[model samples]
Target chain A: MRVVKKAEDRKNEILDAVDELFGQKGFDGTSTNDILEKVGIARGTLYHHFKSKEDIMDALIDRYAVRLIDGAQEVAADKSIPIVERIIRVVMALNLSGGSSEQIMEHIHKPQNALMHQKIQKVIINGVPPILTEIIREGIQQGLFSTPFPYECMEMVVIYASTVFDDDLVVMTEKERSSRIVAFVCNVERLLGAESGSLMDVMGMFGEGDESSRD
Target chain B: MRVVKKAEDRKNEILDAVDELFGQKGFDGTSTNDILEKVGIARGTLYHHFKSKEDIMDALIDRYAVRLIDGAQEVAADKSIPIVERIIRVVMALNLSGGSSEQIMEHIHKPQNALMHQKIQKVIINGVPPILTEIIREGIQQGLFSTPFPYECMEMVVIYASTVFDDDLVVMTEKERSSRIVAFVCNVERLLGAESGSLMDVMGMFGEGDESSRD
Candidate 1:
């Protein structure tokens, strides 16, 4: 007697194993056999789903892209969530704080995942602005935002922020970092056509240290 | 007569040559001979400056680190510039729009430079906060910023801005990007202890499209 794994289920198991191994040993360091060993599948079964190591990596990347887009898409579909909260949730969904997310992020950042990293960036650059545009549109309709070129404004804002404020790009001392956050938050209202200085209540109120203010 | 390049001068020349060649053709693509040929130096001359190709990369990275720190340090020394303006200048210095900035950035982001990228991140984390901290101290002296734990505030702020706002990490929809800029500008006054959102004017007005004139 033997267990017969469905094609989709078996493919997911292989992908999950590959994702974990890639995260642990990096794309270059891992081999097909390692993936096979982790998933305990036959060579035929492995090749049946993926053509090569790179193919597996591609599948893994595709999985991440789908999950990421799906997360944002779900938020976009939900009408009950406030625009600001939805924006935050959408961004937070992109972050890897729980469950398999840490593993996924670690795998993607590995040196061999350079292409994968760039691919993810491409998805972000091409995909994100439109989603945010919709949120901005909703805000505009609800009188929550007042921008004439909501989409263009968001584009410039996103480009500047995604590049310069990236921790990976520029390092700031504590004072500089705080000032930037303050500066960044203050500017958001204007970007959205809201009154200037209207969003200051949450500037420094974002991290775990601010637990005292949770109400 | 044979050219007699001084050791330090030759060392700088080799590093510069490595920077250009590496910029044009990434680490894997450029050979040692290519570096020697372009620099018009012999293999012996190249070795005298650096132990190997990787060594040349290391020297170039060290040079970039120094240049980067120098940019931040210059602003730190100028006590007269308004703190927010100084921060803007510092960001401006890092614009990567001219001279060696673009070359350095491309080279650093090449696949082989993943570790180098991480090194730059560490440098930013270690270096930038204190530079901004000095401004905060000044702001405090002038009764502008009010934070009991300025250091922690700065740390979280830097981590968020550098990471989240980083174009490399999170792609932005145009609307999202604009909102970020607006938020940043509006929050600075709050972070600095000025009247909440006093520095809001800088948003959408700062940073130049200064690339066309650069060589």
Candidate 2:
């Protein structure tokens, strides 16, 4: 008997294949034929799912955005984790490393795909602050934060982090990057009205372990 | 005596005309012919100074960059102003409002002029940070800032402020903008280790004077 796959599953499989191909070959370097060949899907089946290669890329971006948002939301909503740790965990969860999302970011950062870059930035700028704002509000309830402008505070933080630390936007030496991360966490603690050195633990997430190493 | 304008003076006149044209018609909409007619210069004279319309725009950007850097440098170097006040003053001087710089920024921000927008961003990313870093170093000397990463901190500040507060990058409501200004000043204070509420006065330069006006 012949086996059949669900429509959603087949679509997701195509996205997964394309995601890997994009990460490896970049968006420009990868063609629809490459995606079709990798997925072993007939041209008609691929066309049934996506109108064009750009359409597939758009879907991939949506998938990546959803994945990131879900990961962040999961960490933020977990009542079991300490709020401080949750904050750090939520940020860590959003870190793009060795993933298809990381690959997509790398691909779009290239000069040719500026439109793609802008689209991704729009998603982050609009989608992220609200996700982070929820965590800030939780921190406020827990007496960990005391800002009147919780959403706005998170907006600035998101914009700063999304742009400054965005490898595509601002290039920095590793040492320069490490220092910014330390500075970022220190100011973030103050921004939320938390204790001076409370969030310093996040340094290890960026690979600079311990405060003593900073000096 | 025959009228003989200095090369620099003639260059300035062409730039001034093109600046007005760009402000009025945008970079793409304003043609080289428009510049020639507006400047009342022959095509030969216009070509002598700038190879093309894009070249003129690049030159205008350079001039604007110099003007902003010079303005900020003057404020930063003045010993008469208090160090904290100097930081505020230097930022205020760089504010893009009601000038050729503002017009140029608006023109470049149009969707069709993404290249121009990127070029201007490169100028800011490369140029503005050092000028602001000098003020930050001064702040460190005055005991106003205690951060070890003064230059990097300033880089973060400039990047955040340049993008978040940039009128073109992110569209915001009046109320939204007012709140962001408060959050920005608050975070910047912490970023430099300045006391909370010390830099709140910078809000006035943004025309939102006094935090009390924020609802």
Candidate 3:
């Protein structure tokens, strides 16, 4: 008996299989036949869901963008967290890791998948600033920060951090990386008009340890 | 009778021809045969200088990088200019405009030439910061600015400016662009610990007029 699955479930099954296949074999290495065999789906079904492997990659990117922005929005909405810590948490939430995401990150990091990498960066540059801007506005109201252009300020900060600290873009030694983090935090403090050392705690997040361990 | 030319001169002649051709026809639109015909060089000579059209484009990028950095360095080295004004001039010099450059910019801005755009951005990100850092150090000694991480600070600033203001990356209305400039100048003051309004003059340079007319 053929498995009768809903269209949504069937689409996700294909995506899930492709996601693992992409992670293991990399996007270019994984063939459409590989995806079809892994999902036990006919070529027609696969075509129905995705036009091509690149289409599947685009879908994965969309899913990741949604997951990332939703995670950040959740953190941003949590008022119980202090504004500073909340901002840090929001940034931390944007880090793509854990389980398949690690593999996905590796896949995108491959030189061949530069377009994928650019797409992800484009998502972050366009998406994250507004989420963080809401928190910044609160900080301004609390008299903890001051900026007339909260959105633009965060856009600049996000663009800078994402680009300069990208391992692919600039290679940094341990010493250089640490110093850059220090400078980053310092400049962020200045950008937000926060008191000096107020955002210094952010340095801990960049330390050579897991976020949970730091916590 | 055979005419002889120096290897260096022949390479430049090829480059100069391709530069104009690329400006008129774009990187993708121009071809090897076109370059050969335009330069009036045999295919053998063209291959001697550049293995391929991509190789020629790489050479053009290097030439542009040197021209941009050297121009910025000259402005940065000028002691007669005030620290604030010099910063503006150094940034202004980095703008890729003027005859062939304007066309080069348009060519790189095309979607198909993204890798070329990325390369040019990498040059500016890596090259401009060091040149500006020297000026920032002078500012520190002159009591006009203070930052322990002058190099890192300039890196972040250049990366942000180059990425955000990039026409391909983010689209902004005229009003939005003006406001971003205001915020950028404001934040740069905070980043360098300069007094407020000291960098306001930088805004005039970004207005909707040529730098010479502004002066």
Candidate 4:
């Protein structure tokens, strides 16, 4: 019996194969023939789904964004979690560095892939802010936070976190990293008008050794 | 009497022409021939100073960095200005979106010049934090700020400002822009552990029309 996959599933299968190939061989090293041979798809079929290799990379980025957004949305929707904890969890869940996300980041940073990098940045910058804003708004209603500029606050937070935590963007020593985590949480507490030290528990999650309050 | 220029003066003259040409015609549009014609230099002299257009661009970036650093240093050294106002002035002096700075930014953002963009970003991410840190340290001594992580705080501040205020990175509606200005000042106060409204004067510089507190 032939296992007939739906068009969407077939498309996803191609993406998964290329994602692995890109990880192993990088964007420039991976050839279309490699993809076709790995996926066992005719050249026409592959072309039917994607115009070119770059198109395939775009699809992979979209797939990655969807997964990230879904993970963040799940944490945002968990009413059982406290509001501040929920925000921290949402941030942790969106850390796209350890696994396939790292590979995607590498691929986009290639000089020829500048456009792809821009597109992914647009997704994170424009898309992630609203999702975080929803959580911030929830905190505002509960009086755990208070800010009429919820959207802008979340935008500022996302921009700061994305840049500081983005290993590709800026490298930091262990001391610098730990210190930043402290500064980050301190400002975040003040940004939301939460009581001082309310968000300091985030340092524990970040494994920051120095927990001394800035006196 | 013929005014004989030294080698250094000739180099500066060529740089001035290429800078204006790159500003008017971009990195790609202006050719070596255009630079030669504009500067009235023989091909040998041009090649003697710069091997390629990219090398010329590197020189230009170096010059830009020096100018920016000098401007920020002057502001940082001026003890007459208040500490909070000094930070704001230093940031304003580093604005890369007007005059020659704007041209350099446009040239770097071109797709073919991704390497140039990365090089410039490296300068900003690594070079900028320490310069801002000096001012932050001054603020700490004056009892205007209370932060143990002064360098990290400055890093965070630069990353946020460079991204949000970078016209190329993120686009905001006019209202969104105004709100971000307010939010930026608000968080900066908290990050430095200054009084709640201590840095609100930055809003006046930014022409923030809507000063309503984000309650």
Q: Which candidate is the best by lDDT?
A: 3
Candidate 3 vs 4: which has more TM-score:
3
**Quality of candidate 1 docking, DockQ:** 0.12
In candidate 4, position B8 carries an lDDT of 82
Expressed as tens digits, the lDDT of each residue in A157-195 for candidate 1 is 454454344324454676765576566555566456565
Candidate 1 or 4, higher lDDT? Answer: 4
Candidates 2 and 4 compared by lDDT, better number: 4
Clashing residue pairs in candidate 2 (N, C-alpha, C atoms within 3 angstroms): none
How do the residues B76-181 of candidate 2 rate in per-residue lDDT, one tens digit apiece?
Answer: 7788877776776666555445333454455555554554565666667666778778777877887877776677667667766766766355778878776777
DockQ value for model 2 = 0.32
Q: Name the candidate that leads on DockQ.
A: 3
Residue A102 lDDT, candidate 1, scale 0-100: 42
Superposed on the true interface residues, model 1 gives a C-alpha RMSD in angstroms of 7.8
Candidate 3 chain B lowest-lDDT run of ten:
B95-104
TM-score of 1: 0.60
- On the 0 to 100 scale, the lDDT of residue B73 in model 4 is 78
lDDT of 3 by residue, A1-215 (tens): 57878988998898898778876777667889998899997889899877876788889889888877777788889999899988876775664332223444555554445456667778888899999999999999999998888998899888887676553566678688768878888889988989989889754654535544655
Which lDDT value does model 2 have at B169? 58
Candidates 1 onward: DockQ, in order: 0.12, 0.32, 0.50, 0.39
What's the lDDT of the predicted structure labeled candidate 1?
A: 0.63
- What value does DockQ give for candidate 4? 0.39
In terms of docking quality, model 1 is: incorrect
The Cα RMSD across the true interface for model 3 is 1.5
Worst 10 residues of 3 chain A by lDDT: A95-104
Sort the candidates on DockQ, descending order: 3, 4, 2, 1
